[model samples]
Target: MADFKSIKVTKGIKTLEIDNPTGYHLIGMGAQGAVFKLSEDRCVKIYTSPLQAKMEREALKAGQHLSFFPRLYEYGDNYNVIDYFNAPTLKEYLRNCTYIPESIAMKLLDILGEMKKAKFTMVDAPLRHIFVLENEELKLIDHVNAFKRIHPVPLKLLRDLNMMLLKESFLSRVKKLEPKTYEMWQAYFNENKMDYRNIPVDPGGDGEGVKVDSAISQTLIGAGHQGAVYRVSENKCVKIYPKTQHCEQEKDVLLSHQDLSFIPKVYETGNNYVVMEYLSGPDLNTFLKKQSALPPVVSKLLLKILTSQKQAGFKQIDAPLRHVFVTNNGFKMVDHVYSYSRIQKRPLELFQNLHERGFLDAFLEQVKVLDPATHAEWTKKPIPLTDEEAQLEIINIEGKTDSKRKKGKDQGKDRDKGRDHKKGHNRDRDRSQKREHGGKRDNGDKKNRNRSKEHGRENDRKKRSDRIK
Candidate 1:
């Protein structure tokens, strides 16, 4: 084995070498190798571990059986360069959020199944190693601890004593640190609305809502486990529930602040179905198709929407262009299934249950203050686009239309009118379709639980007063 730094690419057809200021242009540093962007459409991974070449070969060969894995383009001298994907990682995709769309999540589950069938295990399945590329394809990178068998850790405990001690400590912490999150989860279970409780709950059903076939809408736009999105109407869309009740709650929070900015409007809703005002317009991805990055103006409008949401007391949505609707009017956020939340679990329980029972309506009825000053912090930033960038964007849009003319008739018309008023406003229809299958969050569930928890305590106090009576 030659030192990767010392080995020069000479006349071999196998290894293509380059000389640069840094020894190896770092792509990402992990347990095994360092990734590098070799070219625009290509990247290379150089293993830094002891058996760099061996691990690379093994991982590459193993990945050959899996579609989501990157194709092994070339491997030599402890370096392997393959297809370059200009998309975001799963971790980057799910910023401080949970619950993806069912359709996309199924695809991810499928990938997991394939990996399992092939006897591959990703020990550290954090969000970063998975990439969601254009064309809605999923690819896996960083395979340092892949394909290993695991031994289960079993613990035997003394039931009665352990329960008494552990119960107080755990519940005490829950009461202090994450009281709201705990209350939300308790409300969900108390009301039998555990449909979205986590992976492997009924393998995918909790019957909290109309049980729509998760597969029917699974083909909608999604990269990995985010679930599929479909076009519903010109002015509305819905996100199918992929994980939990938090999906519905996220939308509710976004809706409450509708007057603040360009967030989508929540219209009708079901256990799984949530109708929202469809945003027309191409996503930044479609608008910037083939371009490496977004122009200044488009990015500015997009950021403005995000800034507004944050100012409105809603966590920012972290998905890229796929989750955004970029229209002539501006930008609109489509998915909040994985929006940021401070509450760890069941963050949406209180708000969601309240909204369902018209409690929110009554609460807002008393409030006259709708402040825009919350978002004033954003005005200080320079606008994202320049005149030159906007002009280039318009030119690119025209060029794109011209290129699509060859597709013919209905296809061409659809492509041409992809920016039309009605269809344009219907940008996130797929999101609605995904949301329809999941059950709705019931505020009554919380109300019921609180009533139950208070019953015995209230009765005891009532008896004490009865003695006086």
Candidate 2:
């Protein structure tokens, strides 16, 4: 080991000055300290402050059992000796490669797993600290924040990958191999408002535009009259239009409002398609269905969207409820084809839809409390139903009236038929009783005449008998 007393270390106001009389070649320098090569397999890092040196030594000692970490050999008050990797950094190695391979992704996951096993609170490291060996092995150099800070995911590593256009490819493997870890990382990213998609600013050269590879499979997420949206990756989607002008219109609108959090980041524009950030959540229409009542936050977000559009210089300050997506941060609007070209002063389409669904009253109440000026402007004219809605209502009312009228007519016909049959039966019974009574009277008279004739003959015979006596 080199003599520590001979090496002169000076701390400046905002920098560290190292005077090496021990003939150690300078290798690396950082905010904490400077590293010098001591031998073919080892190096010494001298810190500006003893505290940082002690912290790094403890971190190295905690991870010494892991193969990825440099082996710690010796330690002092302000210096420590550890293994030196004579290899290229991960950033340098990726410059020559077309894309990140799945093997590299697996190794990165394994390194994170090792960090977790070593009880590291911060399972993250910068790409510059990661060395790629000739045999495809990875080794980490700096151990300053390995056990000091807290990070649930490898955020630095992912950000570096995104810079190199390898993040999506790496995450695809992560999703397939370690689904649970993938979900956890996604949750962390969304909570932190970090976008993980590798959106290239200039994807093509010489004005040729980027062409989507034919072999890349995409799943259709949604479709509309103007275009269709396909999810190309976990965090990226492509909107395809029938005409190039339609694609250009939406792309321009997105680019103009890129600084707005509610506007999705547009990646690239093609002849008939545009790739952008994939916002995952239910649209406002679907979200409202699951809600028992229109939450005040939703109404506020809707008003914010319109205000943002107006501020962004869009003539059409309205978006259909289906185009607005509910995200963790707030609502994000998509499909901006008509935002610039159409002349819509207010969100009438949205209000009309809410009216039909019986949510307009509640929505307006929230808006009234939130922005009375906008409420006044919106309610200045009573929101009339759309032509289609008016036609449908008329059909429904007419149908009900016609059904009731037909039912009443059928009931009256049944009552009249019943009364006519009862009157005809009573009249026939009266005629039959009269005929039987007349026949009885006629028979009684005939009997009386016969009796009278017999009585007269008896009287004559009695008178003759009396004379002979």
115-139 in candidate 2: lDDT tens per residue? 9888898888756778888778998
Please list the residue runs of candidate 2 whose C-alpha ends up more than 4 Å from where it truly belongs after superposition: 1-5, 11-14, 194-469
Model 2 gets an lDDT of 0.63
Q: Assess each prediction's global lDDT (C-alpha) against the native.
A: 0.42, 0.63
In order, what is each prediction's RMSD in angstroms? 26.1, 41.7
User: Candidate 1 on 383-456: residue-level lDDT in tens?
Assistant: 11212211221112123422233423222221111121122333322222211101122212333565675564
TM-score of 2: 0.42
User: In model 1, how large is the Cα lDDT of residue 13?
Assistant: 20
State TM-scores per candidate.
0.30, 0.42
